[model samples]
Target chain A: MTEFDREQHDHFLRLFMGLEESLRVFVRSLLFTHDEEREVMQEVAVVLWRKFDASMDGEAFCRWAFGVARMEALAFRRDRARDRHTFGDEVFELLSQTVLEHSDSLEAERHALDTCLQKLPEDQRQLVQTAYAPGVKIDHLAAQLGRTAMALYKTLHRIRLTLMDCTRRVLATEELT
Target chain B: MNTKDPRFEIIRRSRDGNASSEELARLEAGLREDTDFREAYVRYMNLDVALSAVAKAAPLPLPTAPPQRPRWITWRPLTAAAAGIVFGMLCTSVVFGFVAQRTAVKKMPLSVFDAGLEDAKQILNDGLPSQEGQWGIDHAKVVSADGKVTPLTGLHMLRLEPIPREKRVKNHTSRAYQVLDLRSLSASAMTDNAEAEVSASFCAANSGTSSRYLIRAIALDEAPAKATKNFWSKVESDGVVSESQRFDTAPGSAGWQTFSMTLRLPPGSKTLVLIFGAVPPEDGPQPASVHYLDEVQVSLLSSETPLP
Candidate 1:
């Protein structure tokens, strides 16, 4: 490699090396397996190099890298190959029973969720708080905010999806570690 | 029809706490008839339960672990095609990420002006009385800054003043015309009544037909037949008209025809609309002389009189 290219590669490596372990675990949950997760991380590194190879500032690189990691995981799972295990009645029942019996797993899931919430923007954090506040019904909050119930429902739907992904990643990495 | 199709209704009833035990059993029986529906409903219910539980419980600390790397990173490339495939996938994901980020940044719904109004005016609708028949202001004329007149058409309304011809003489000017359309205007459901009152003013006639124009007002009322027939009957009984004569300086005529008319509305009617039209006489090039209108007011009248 040329000197400039080598410098760029080293810059990308340093950038990838600095991301928090928690962020990595968060990204890995979106992937089906460890190998796929690793593949996504490498792609993230390559993309960071391509984007910021000229300057490679740490802040820009971290954001770019994690953002790329998330996309790669989503794209990887979007492939038809990952749909082999269909979610059916039995699986759903097992999942519910699992949640009921394994309180620690539920707690672990909650912990992962809290961590993910911490990672969100300050505005999003407040939104989650307001949504889940005790005795504050969704319909009442929606009316107070001049929003329809359907709109609030859709917002909660997106938040739930994000939490599921974050929790899955957190638990997966906790197992690995 | 499949029992699964009624799932939403049953769920809504359950959510509302209005479903009886028998109703719940019926819903459950319906759910069991379709495996896919039952599985989906179970998953949805469980997710809701878990999320609700988490929302209720105290926050917990999440695990911290290093992210895994891709398996292909350490693997040797087999061929140029394989390398190219890997490279392409990486590039595509990065582009997709960038696009998603940009889209999120915009945070606005992309909309175009296809609802059909000049200048993209929002269609005014609030349960006001709808137009009974074909109603709109179509013809218009542009007053150039150079004191010249130009014909306008296909444009319904303008909420802006007409830029005078002399002012529109050059690059420093804009071609302006007074336009109006009353098709989409309506009254709010909660409101009692709505009406529009407009007045047109014309500059005195010059050597030619510069300021001479015609003003026409059209109103469309759409309500139930009972309300409309009552409104029409009241208009026929209590309608007032006062006509007078006026002299025109340019034509050196003794008297010209002038008329003023007002129609009272009936009771129980919820919506009333008024549309005004101003047409000008035909000048040198185009025949219609454009007239300038002054004050136009739309007001909701009191609902008190009951129609017989």
Candidate 2:
């Protein structure tokens, strides 16, 4: 590869790596199903790389990237519009706006979530990880645990709420310093 | 935290894509109207995303084995089938009951103007009566702005001009306004001290023009035919009003900006009017300008505490 091409490739990777987590969060907020979210995120990454120009500054990258992600999400929704219980377009708009507005706080919360996950008791953490593992179905997990699906969902919900509360407290305390 | 908070149930159902039509509508309205609910929904969704990310980064563990069945299961097929049928029936009933409850709570809000300026005009001319009373618009034309003839998503948008061309040349200044009667829409759900949220997307033809778009929720003791006669004074006299920040696009900018504001409905108010208008620039070359508006919505923000 030419030196210029190599430099461009490296810069693209750096920006992708820096914003990967936020991009994933943003895409997932618009999409509920994991597979679709992953598909859209991959498409967004490719688009961002192909369009990476020097005019785009680091500070504006997230906003620009999110705009691309939003378009991808809208397309995905159109493709899946016939699916049962799909979110309305207004919901997607609201979510996109909210994520962009809270991107900074969300990044902090993401970090705090990592810390919070590590602090989870071993069994609870294992349950959460296993439940979210790439192809694991919640129904199958519930059957394995000898619990009803509703019970399992409630348990997972509690864990999520706990993490949310913990992250909020951590961010609040951080703001005090 | 209440483990049985209905909001959590709604969020969970929404995340799982099992939320019925009514539940979905309720969730959307809540997100638009309540700050705390919106924040909670965003945080929960973010945490779910974060958890999934963490799971993907970590190595997967071996799957757990299913519980063992008794060896005599072969001989008890008939008995098991009978029991299974009974269990299936019970499960079906429970599922149906849940769905019924969800749909039962569905309250369709009175839609004043959802889309198509022609339909809005027809309704205005026909004087459609809503729960609160009759509804009409002052002066609105469906016009394309900045070459965006089509809406961001819909087919048309209402362009409210601040000053008509003929009137602008005559007086060199005039306030053109469009008011949509929202009393029927708001009165159906809002009580005294109830909070409602109004949301819309707006854009200006030229950023340099003194053109400005303002969305206001005014509580009136009675419906007014036109918005021009001391509306602000009446709003002051009536004492319950909420207005969004005046929105103006930057020069050369070409995109729709979303604006949302929450308002408290006052007691004894018979009508709620949503006013959208452009204020003509005093000294700009383009004294008359049209402000494009679309996707106007109003939803009540419930303040009820979730049941334990």
Candidate 3:
């Protein structure tokens, strides 16, 4: 590749690395299965890389990247419809709109989320981490922990709700200050 | 926010892919109708993704090598032999089972509607005509009658005009509908033992106001006496239409798109109604909206177990 090409490649990589976590969150909000979400994110990354030159500056990167991610998620959902439990088009449309509208606020909340997660009690934090571990089945984890899968899921759900509430409160206070 | 909100449980189960079909349906309805529920659902999913990222960032400890086994310990030859035999049998069965499944399932396209507007027997208008002209199908205009613009296959396409707010006021609402009845074709092809998949290609150009385009699949016990007025009345009442899916069109939305939905026919249903039109905006006069529809197709798949 030419020097200019190499520089463009490096620029694309930097932007991708910076937005990778946010993009994953955006993709995950649209999909249920973890594997499918990751697959869609990978596809989005490739498409973003190819179209990086055409992307405008300012908040355009987030808008364009999330737009691409939305289409990828929709296509993934359509392909997996017959085999898996997937949300309908209307739900996805609403969810995508909500995410895009709140992207800035959500970015702020992400910082607050880190603090909220750190404040989680040791046992709850461990449960949250183990539940989200790569390739780790909730049923298997439940078996290892000597609890029913539903019970464990309920615990995780409660922990997530608590963290979300805490993050919202933190962000709200920050906005006030 | 109530911690005990059952909606949260539904959201959790949905995220985990553990939600039942009924729960999923309820969640979908809530997402469409309830704003607070939708916000909570998004926040919960965002939290799950954030937690997953954190978990992945935290490095896992490297595995330590196990201590060497004692020299005295050894595998039992008989147990090993039995295990090998069982594994071989299991692998053979799995391979054969997979091949059998692949060959047994069949996806057959029962019927395809590729003809022009002549095939459409009934055209019903739910709203009054605008001042420019009557709101109905225009067979003269052609927007890719050959289905090149859209993924539909047909020789002729129907251009449907949207009723303005004044026309909609006659119908008691700002929404207007132009319905095409395909009961003769669909009823003949439908069977109680199979599910029908209906799909259509649509393109819309909205004026200043936004409009919602919908393709509703309705099944009736019998054809209505007055197709236009009574049909809409029945649609207004519950239990008249089987399934309906909507697509929203903004001012700048000007491309052909395709949408498909599977309908489980209700018992004692004889006639099938396919309604296509735009829903008008309330409180003001609606901008002129035009929709081009073509290549409507319905295929049936038999729900029978294949012979081995």
Candidate 4:
């Protein structure tokens, strides 16, 4: 208890909790799936807290944590290379830097995606939810829906397309509001 | 979204994990070459991750055949992500289980307080006080707003009445209480500086009268059920430490206004009862105008930390 002040620990929790989701999203973008990010995120969180400075502001913490997540994920990816297909490190660097630059727009897009998801046809929304649910296998989902795996992937792709369009339109008009 | 755009297809396939080695190479080339394509890549990746989170947090009934956990157990992304900070890296599994178990109701914090009135009921006077994570109204009622009465936050708010159904007497004040079990707190978790920082938003549903609200929180050495038997009048008998905060709304208080108070938790505090009261001035009419309370919160805090 003496190593860290109780107030500083609480402050760390507040800042960490506030930014957890963004950090999760950042880590997830680097990894393959939800479960993979789960492992890396744990390490990233530990490192972040172990090195957290009482003086760092939220923005500084975010940038630093995202950097930690990027490093941890890339390192994890190196060991996980044999199991799955991964984009080149060059692509990862590009996307990571781009997301940081467009953080505001990405945040807007995050909220807009929520709105756009609600705008979908009910069945499509359900399909999207069921398809992306943690641990749901695409083949099983396709079979459950009585469609071929390829057809189901096409349907999901179309739904994402619709959602992306809606989100773009929302962001475009967000300035007017 | 333009189906004809090859870069868009590559981005979508990559997100869906349907891209081949050649397709991934093309995607990497596209990202390195086109600025807009790179933007699209980040957006798609963000969307992909968000969709997975949304799917996990989606309502309990998912249509797929995936192995599903029980409905009550919700996987809060942040909780899992923050578990490591509570314990060391090796203890994260333990901390995560503790937190994940603590949240029986999804989207609700792992605390004894329910700020949003979602789990509360309208049972009035002599009705059992709220259990942990609920509000037990003595004379008032927790009600859903249909249109005539509006809640400050969620669909429901705590409504304070001037008279009690059980007591039918001249009482303009209403009381609601919630209890917290502190046995789960590891002895070393919080220092003596641990405080319960409570906050709630209040609004006057009527016109032309100031309404006051107060919170009485006491830390006891016994269980809440035992403490509630005396309704905290015996706190003095037990020599327990208690704190109270009172605020009065101005005439025509207008929009929802929020207030906060902090109560320090003394050592050996096994149970905590958070008492909420809406008191009309003693000299005012016996049955004052109706007032609404919402967004009630009770958070454990370090001594100096303030509730927002």
Candidate 5:
């Protein structure tokens, strides 16, 4: 075989095997840990390898690979079904993927920070919830929620900083479509 | 804004601290220069108040305790003496039994994995013929609750009775489930050309983890076999919102895995095909025979009720 033949073989092998790494990255972008993402990627690669045809163009192949990855991710999500959570894994996966792809600017991150009310944990959620509620005073809320005025100040400060950081991460990772 | 002003530091430290009037004035001026800082500071102060309130409240609920046993009473001496005599004879038998019990019986309880396997076998036995090629031996195991294939056979002439919304589930290994609802969407054409559309506006209905389902259309075959590639491509190219996102898995995952997609059906399209097959890993076989599926669902995406 000529050198061209060897190069061609390498290209196909890369096409076939490199799909796994791309998928792993995709799963990671969905917030799945490296190992969990790899496990799912393994299943996807096996399926793709079996079904793939060399006749498929690169564009078609990428779409198909993405589709397979999405399906596998969904399947994984369904299998680990949780009853308590509101949004499903697919929505998060898609949203996260889209967000990461489209919105990578600092301005977007800052805006996300300004609107970072969604990611707060339980107590923080309640505090923000009350603060956002109509006509509620901070002093009255402090008294009702039973906080020392000083403690309330500190907690709010920490929450803002955390939200800012979280917003930056979220913006860096995702775009709203 | 320089740090050297002693009066500025005092203003910073004392919101209510025993600070002189002069120090307070200095702090106010510094805050006036940057409204954002003052806003952030006030926000922090408010949060401190709220967190303290929650901690003061009672703890979250705890799990219940087990039931208590009643106290035991002592027996009389004469009765106790008689009971001791009976116990002596019982003790001799118990000792003999203990010696006999030394032999290994080898009778062990079935494990959960074994139980799951047994359930899969039972499901295949009863569900295979009735499932009409919709069921394949994949990594997905048969869930006993929804594995009722026989009773559903020919009742609708379609072997797969979609596991009712409540009972249907996807195990980790299994990929997707396609329930073929052949009912036509268009009233004018009593034929199969009718289409179902899941547009972006209604994407919420299908955009989720477990609740999401894929759309694939396949013809009913005599042997419960898979549909042709032409069928898959036509349905896919026409109905799929993003062609790159269409996925299928091989038949052999040992159980049901879940595949979810947000489908936006093209306008004026007549049909939607959802394939619930598993995608094998890259290192695995080409055109792998992991599993096969013939069952699929056809419904109007925009309609309130899915076609039967």
Candidate 6:
């Protein structure tokens, strides 16, 4: 490989891969569906890498990366202007800005989820994992388990709330100690 | 964490695709006005992303050992694997292959638009009291599944509510026109005996009067934009075929039923416009009556050569 190309790949891969999860969560928070998140994340990665510089440090790079993510996600939302579920441009701007402000706390909550997930009952944790498995459709899973789709959805929602409660407790306890 | 909170319902339904437009509006408002709601929203979404990442990294939950939250799924593993000089050349190709595949990523599913309405907004639905987004509608208000109903598959379904009496015209059935491009198929699939099979799931309130689930399929040699002009004018003579199922939904009736119709493509047809319609009985529409549409699909069938 050419020295110029090798340097670009090395520099881009290190920073980009390291921040991949943050960028994903950032973009996903701004969009409605997982597919939309995947789409916007790709666009964000391309824009970040294409304009990436070796001189930029972690903080500057993160700011720039998040800015790109915000724009791309908004653009994606605008394309679906007909969709009723999507946030309007004003609401989207407000939410994205809020997410940026709370990025650090959100990241902490994200870490807490790892521990909270383990605290769940074995069956519930198994179900949550199965639900989020790659390309796992709830309907198909429901049929396999002899449960109706609505029943399955209700169960999943309850599990998520439990996880949320667990994470909040974990974070609060951490604050105390 | 309060399931009883309206905010929880709104947020959960919005994520699950069950929230109506009104509920979504409330969610948007809460996200803007309430700081607590905003924190909850951020936390929920953060948890969602983290769970998905963990689930993706370890598809099977480890009952015995805790699965680590994967920071970057493949990077560390690949670097460790690359430490061996014996497989230097092989490792380089594999790493480049993975990077190239990731860097060159395109957007989602192969279809140009999401047919399932689960992802992209290619399919136009529910413009207002008398319109279906870009497509004009009949005596129907394309509405979202509300407290009384839910979507057949995804979080959203087209609920064909009655149009206002003053705005309603006589003999106008409640339906939406779906214009599908015939150019999407292979040349071999567009034969003299080629047929376009149209199918969609329909549902009604169980305590409703009898209603006719209707479908009218037509093939045109003109473009989609031009086909609509001559659409209602054409009948079931050559390229068009219509089929329907009339039923009286009882207390324990089937919720959503799939209906289909097939239209033989007139040779050299360029487009297909399907009318997914609903016909009420001679009696006026009932308060509990509903005509819902979801999971619409169009596929090719042939007498000689199979659909490629």
**Against the true structure, whose DockQ is highest?**
6
Which lDDT value does model 6 have at B159? Answer: 64
Residues B160-251 of candidate 5: C-alpha lDDT, one tens digit per residue:
22222233344322233322222222332222211221110001111122222232333222112232223435333322222223343333
Writing each residue's lDDT as its tens digit, candidate 2 over A104-147 gives: 88878876776677677878888988887666789898999999
Cα displacement (angstroms), candidate 4, residue A175, comes to: 2.0
Docking class of 3: incorrect
Selected candidate, larger lDDT, 2 vs 5 = 2
| Global local distance difference test of model 5 | 0.33
What is the C-alpha local distance difference test score of candidate 6?
0.58
Name the lDDT value of residue B287 in candidate 3: 55
Question: RMSD to native for every prediction?
Answer: 30.1, 25.0, 24.0, 20.4, 27.9, 18.4
Worst 10 residues of 3 chain B by lDDT: B81-90
DockQ score for model 4: 0.16
Candidate 4 stretches greater than 4 Å from native: A1-5, A83-90, B1-4, B60-308
Ranking by DockQ: 6, 3, 4, 2, 1, 5
DockQ of each candidate, alpha-carbon based: 0.03, 0.14, 0.17, 0.16, 0.03, 0.21
Which residue runs does candidate 5 get wrong by more than 4 Å?
A: A1-12, A17-20, A81-177, B1-308
Flag the better candidate by DockQ, 1 or 6.
Answer: 6
Q: What would the TM-scores of all predictions be?
A: 0.23, 0.46, 0.47, 0.51, 0.22, 0.48
Model 2 chain B: which ten-residue window has the lowest total lDDT?
B81-90
True contacts kept of 2: 0.35
Model 3 residue runs over 4 Å out of place are: A14-19, A58-61, B1-4, B60-308
Q: Candidate 2, DockQ to 2 decimals?
A: 0.14
Worst 10 residues of 4 chain B by lDDT: B76-85
lDDT of 5 at B113: 13
lDDT of 1 at B58: 21
TM-score of 5: 0.22
| Clash totals for all candidate models | 24, 1, 0, 1, 64, 1
Query: In terms of lDDT, which candidate is stronger, 2 or 6?
Result: 6
